[model samples]
Target: MASGNDMKMAEETYSGFIGLVKWGTILTAVVAVIVVLLIA
Candidate 1:
């Protein structure tokens, strides 16, 4: 029972981490493009 709960928690955390990274990368790319446009 404890192991099952732990597995669920880990899976949630992993998914949350992936979500953050996905959004973070997208945001970073957008900001970079904006900066380049402004500089140009």
Candidate 2:
């Protein structure tokens, strides 16, 4: 059904968004650690 397909698409989009946020946070944390080490 079209409605079922639409729901699947929405779920995929939501998953991708969460993945992006998680990766962004991890990257930021890594960068922060590197900067701190460099400055020290």
Candidate 3:
């Protein structure tokens, strides 16, 4: 049984991780497009 505080902390960590991953994916795609354009 997890305590309320522990659950809240876990949720916050998960949200932050998700946000990081979302931004990372967007950055990767943008960089890829730029690279392709430079090559072409």
Q: Pick the candidate with the highest lDDT.
A: 3
Stretches off by above 4 angstroms in model 3 are none
lDDT of 2 by residue, 1-40 (tens): 5598899999999999999999999999999999999999
lDDT of 3: 1.00
Q: How many clashes would you count in candidate 2?
A: 0
Give the TM-score comparing model 3 with the true structure, all chains together.
0.94
lDDT value for candidate 1? 0.97
Q: What is the TM-score of each candidate against the true structure?
A: 0.92, 0.79, 0.94
Score each candidate by Cα lDDT: 0.97, 0.97, 1.00
Cα misplacement distance, residue 28 of candidate 1 (Å): 0.2
lDDT of 3 by residue, 1-40 (tens): 9999999999999999999999999999999999999999
For model 1, residues 1-40, the per-residue Cα lDDT tens digits are 5598899999999999999999999999999999999999
Q: Compared to the true structure, candidate 1 yields what TM-score?
A: 0.92
Give the per-residue Cα lDDT of candidate 1 at 9.
97
- What lDDT does candidate 3 reach at residue 40? 100
Please list the Cα RMSD from the true structure of every candidate, rounded to 1 decimal place.
2.1, 2.5, 0.5
Q: Flag clash pairs in model 2.
A: none
Best by TM-score: 3
